[model samples]
Target chain A: MADAKPETKPKKTHQERMARKKQVIDERIAKATEERGVLILLKGNGKGKSSSAFGTMARCVGHGQKAAVIQFIKGRTETGEFKLFKDHPQIDWHVMGHGFTWETQDKTQDIAAAEKAWAQAEQLLQDDSLDMLVFDEMAYMFKYRYLELEPVLKALQNRPKNQHVIITGRVMPEGLLEIADTISDIRDERHAFRLGVKAQAGIEF
Target chain B: MADAKPETKPKKTHQERMARKKQVIDERIAKATEERGVLILLKGNGKGKSSSAFGTMARCVGHGQKAAVIQFIKGRTETGEFKLFKDHPQIDWHVMGHGFTWETQDKTQDIAAAEKAWAQAEQLLQDDSLDMLVFDEMAYMFKYRYLELEPVLKALQNRPKNQHVIITGRVMPEGLLEIADTISDIRDERHAFRLGVKAQAGIEF
Candidate 1:
């Protein structure tokens, strides 16, 4: 008993542990065989929801796929994403909002803008040639009652089966969440803005 | 008294309300004038931490700025980001891990790889020419105790004043969080993988 090895036991245990872990992961990977487009919802108060969408769009472009972006709440065309992607042959970009809600100062005008944006979005939804679509900050329309959710949901449901969509915003309606294939809720643990740091270019936008 | 103008009262009230809101936002935006590099930590269990970083990288690149990415946990060079950005004139990319931890199966080698990756990261931190640096999944090293937190913290503190850095992973050390100017916690509300959907290219990658 005194001569029994101690280090070997731990080594064997470690190997066994790793083997079990690998098997589980491998099985999961194997079990997941279906390939199709998915609906991804990025929600929360943190700062990367739009950035993540743009990053995915960039990834899709990397694969030579066509992509489109419809900015539902932003009125500015000078954003970093717009500057970079506006003229790219692989990307189709649109800025639909007139401006921030406060800036517009009229409920009727805001509704009109949202309706117009949705019209464009509906057209894109019907375009099967597009591989991906990013509905940046589109949830705000639903939150502010600028756009009806039912028709939007119906359009999403009937969109091209292989067309991926990434929707980003702080306020997500329940219907969108219900249909999402993946949802990432970005939480704000801390922010430099609270510390009086200016939102700078190439970062905040 | 019954003849008093009801609609006029509400319209005036709305204007006053908007005026107050505008003042507050204007003050905040005006107060935040200082600009410099920031450390952003993206944590929690969700997809898009890396995607956010990549998106930010694209934004930075859009501004004609330079970026470098040191992927601490990814071993594959065939990822969509790599294919799109590998030879990009503005990006410097490196994949420093042997693969997932279970795939490596050796703590010694894992630690060694982490150390090597950190060494590259440390060097990049000192280079002011690189406008941004992304330490993808580097948190796993600190979580596993493969890399000491103090040295990394010190390097970050002493790094170029104008260089922005983004660290993405689920496990974040307190020191990193403490120094981070922005922190995004990505929570997984739902995942397609759990529903037997395969992780597809240009989306999962």
Candidate 2:
């Protein structure tokens, strides 16, 4: 917490150690008192970037919170996540991507797709009834400059104070990270693909 | 693919650029043709470690895949995740922790709880009917040495070859990370808790 006591005493016993740690932790817990929808950015090359985004959205359903998602850069019906949340309640799910940029080389087409996705994102940002909004792989759209940064920033800044928005992708746009309330840059010591393990159903996709 | 041509050509047109990138990507995609269940590890001090794990389990429910989970460290029925997956089919869920280490100072009682949880984990490991097995916060048990390493390793080694396992927590055990097929060390540059924002109902739990 903001007023946590500094560890100056020797914690020789387990009881003492716990007491010291608890004193600090309790204060930290007390310091966190705000209750509002947060903007979470899951950015990195690691897996679970989108999975984490989708996972939180899934939690919203069980907790009786309304949520919506606008995926950019890539969308596919074959994905396990898409199949699961396609018809679920409280999920205004939209997979607006054609494919990964590596697969779709046409920049103009990709830009058009991104713009369409952004339109939906803007709409979601404006809707105050929603509780969570996910822009899966929206970073690619920003990184590629398919859409201008001003509108995206404006939407994020002007969205309903109670609506949590999650942006996920490999490269964290420096500007976006600056404004996000929480930024998780997921990384890995090693990757499965590097060692010849292929992406599997219900695991990677 | 294994035999993909390196990008040596200078692409002047968008069509040419797309073709070049697509050729390499197609080959890379072709190279990954194997199908097997993987061991995924989500570990770090950052948020979303458990969210990523539970989210995937939720995905399993909708995708017709059987998934089981054993949550260690802290298990409370009031969690949003518990409310979401309590009645879902194809899920074998078990919450076997009284509380976190800081809350429960009794090592013996904690060990007993971990053993009970491990009993369920061991059972799931041997079942072979499950597609995914999640050891939610199991790393804490391992790090604390509440559960022995030998039996756990043996179970993992002896489990069904195609079964996927997910372990999530901070400070991943060295041994568990070694055997895990995939590892995501989620890191947040700035935690919301540090910023005095409390964990929200749907977002944190």
Judged by lDDT, which candidate is best? Answer: 1
lDDT of 2 by residue, B22-83 (tens): 89876776787766667788988788898898777766656789998888877687777777
Return the top candidate by TM-score: 1
TM-score of chain A of each: 0.92, 0.90
What would the per-residue lDDT of candidate 2 be over residues A1-205, giving only the tens digit for each residue?
9799998977576656666778889999899998777889998878778888887887777798888988786667777778777887778889899987667767888999999898888999989999999888888887888889888998899989888999898887777888888988898767777666687777877
| iRMS, model 2 (angstroms) | 1.7
- Fnat, model 2, is 0.57
Docking class of 2: medium
Interface Cα RMSD for all candidates?
Answer: 1.7, 1.7
Error of 1 at B164 (Å): 0.7
Instruction: Identify the runs in model 1 with alpha carbons over 4 angstroms from their true place.
Output: A1-13, B1-16
Q: List the residue pairs that clash in candidate 2.
A: A1-A28, B1-B27, B1-B28
